[model samples]
Target chain A: MKPEAPMTAEQSLALITRMIDQAKGNVTRNAFYFLLWGWIVLIANLGMFVLIKLSYPYPFAIWLITIPAWAYTMYASFKRQKETSALTHLDSISGWLWITFGVCIITLIAFGYRINFQINPVILLFCSIPTFMSGVILRFTPLKFGGVMFWIFAIVSFIVGHEYQFLSGAAAIAFGYLVPGYLLKRKESQ
Target chain B: MFDELDPLLHSQLRLAVMSLLISAEAAEFTFLKEKTNATAGNLSVQLDKLQEAGYITVEKSFKGKKPLTTCRITTKGIQAFEKYVNTLKQYINK
Candidate 1:
């Protein structure tokens, strides 16, 4: 890469193409976030289902776990920001997109009581947007499949009864986030 | 009938640097060095040259206790790169 080397037009095109492909950036690190949220929500969904089946009074209280998960996500993001040496434009946009998704989820939670807490379907529907968008951004097919699964499961939750809605939500998170998350983790590791 | 290539982007290492910077929002000095496999001294010198031409902006700051240098391509750099590519395309297509 010496500056003095005379590069021909063809060589210049080759170099530009090689360098641009190399600059695709490390988007695979997103696997960790996907896996984290996937597991957390998966557990919460199944936990609510179990509590409901047991006739527990505070079945909905299971969602309080997201508070700690949110704190941990923020702390990890700050630490990650410190170590990142480059920022891709697509990555920046994806980060902002997820932030918007978080705002939407919060809005849903605040207004859930008005709809009699029929939040599972709406939450899964919101999840599909960022998941599908990230797949498009990263050119990862599994994530797109996961996004499709989320949509299907959202519909499933709408069709199911109260206690079974959590079960449908659990299946949604399993296929949507957990499955893609694991695949992404494996791909990144490779 | 062909436009001349921009001399600043006609060389090997500088062109590689611009290529990397053009695609990224920002890249660190170490990242460029690692990707280019260029010596630190040489990369630093070439970066200064691009900075002088106003083709890129270099920021020097501290990342914790260590110094960090980040580079980003400028609007002028994009234009120059584009012009150079168009010119090169003319040469090769001829």
Candidate 2:
């Protein structure tokens, strides 16, 4: 029979302490990302409601259905565990897709109708700034780098071309959120 | 000369959690619990220790009226992690 090695006091305490640190990190990151994404969804959806109301007749009825869609997406996102690596990326992408679609619809409606409201791409561009900063704060290179790309695209769209604004939003999804999120998920799996 | 890492931050389970969190923006209690395969009571206890050490901060709030607890690493914690890694590298290189 092999002799069991005695665990040192230093070893045990160090082990316990390390676990605690990690648990704390996990809790913090999840909460921040969830809130960040949730707010983005809410803002996008609310924008959608406003545009739909202004552009179409009988807006309240549409708002009712749109609210449910938003709720459903929220439920799905919250209920989802970090299961399959691919699923996690898919979920983020899909959520961003909803926000992108909502934003694009509103933009189209507002621009098409020539509503007096100036479509300030700058405001939308600035909104993404924090997300990019969050990526930097976390020190994840993929997210940080991708965030820069999103920021660049945002700036370009606002300064150069309003026609590509919606496309910029889609690009944000592909690079900033989805791709890096997927890569992280893959690293986790490995 | 690099000394050994403080034993307090060098345990396997703790190291695993920290490693995961180092890469994450934030993660949930459940997520950490599942990943580390630690019991709820054990994980909670460990988390409190880290919070007490000033290596992390804990936030207690309610989500939809359900009690929600979250954690985040502090600057102090990141520094300690880096130092610990450097300490370990000394042994490997030596």
Candidate 3:
């Protein structure tokens, strides 16, 4: 009998199909993990900002805490990308870091311009528009949801102004990032 | 019942490589190798197979003087994956 030709294209294609399903599963799980970590960082960063502003001798120095937080986040993200070969994992972390960094800078400016500035968190609403669009582009639900939360909270925060900004931030962290992230992780485990 | 499963995806390593590429927007050769736990020579061979089959598209470039190979799933690959899952469902359900 003739030696069997290398596996047929149809066969290979079939195998690749199954593989994609597995990959999709992995991608979703990784997305969740990134969101969780993102929520953690957001909560910690905002909490620190509030505490320093209220009680610390030098509140401005407190924002420096982000440097270490960023370093840790990047390190953890890099390791996960290496271990899983799941590009979505790294992408989610990188995307969120960019979002958070933007938020921090804007907040700093708001604080600096306190007397002259209207202290409008309303500006933050504009920020989430592009981010939400990006989530649709990436086709990841968690990031997409996070983006929407940003938009929704932006409106609420702006309506309430600085009075309820911290509470808004907390709610955003919970619904936008934390819950979604944990659910993704739980689904993957199943 | 088992006949419904796609024969191509039956290989262990090829399946792993495709799985890695599927999750990534793009993946480098080294990334695929580490994730699949395959040797460079072996991984390259399997990648060539996927490329030849048109299920994946590979791009070669130099990253800071180092050779880099990146892979992404083609549209054809995506369709094939969906069909394969349906086939798998038939087998499992049976």
Which predicted model would earn the best TM-score? Answer: 1
Q: lDDT tens string, model 3, A27-129?
A: 4235444464456546654775587558767544544655676577567766665454345544665557556756765576657576554333544454455
Model 2 chain A lowest lDDT segment of ten: A82-91
Q: Candidate 1: misplaced stretches above 4 Å? A: none
The lDDT leader among the candidates is: 1
The 10-residue segment of model 1 chain A with minimum total lDDT is A20-29
When 1 and 2 are scored with TM-score, the better candidate is: 1
Judging by DockQ, tell me the better candidate of 1 and 3.
1
Clashes of each: 0, 14, 4
Which TM-score value belongs to model 2?
A: 0.43
Candidate 1 chain A TM-score vs. reference chain A:
0.94
Q: What is the iRMS for every candidate structure? A: 0.9, 9.4, 7.4
Candidate 3: give the clashing pairs: A11-B8, A12-B8, A15-B9, A17-B81
**Which residue runs does candidate 3 get wrong by more than 4 Å?**
A1-13, A31-62, A86-143, B1-94
**Model 3: share of native contacts present?**
0.31
lDDT of 1 by residue, A82-161 (tens): 78887777778888998899999999999999999989898999999999999998999999999999999999989999
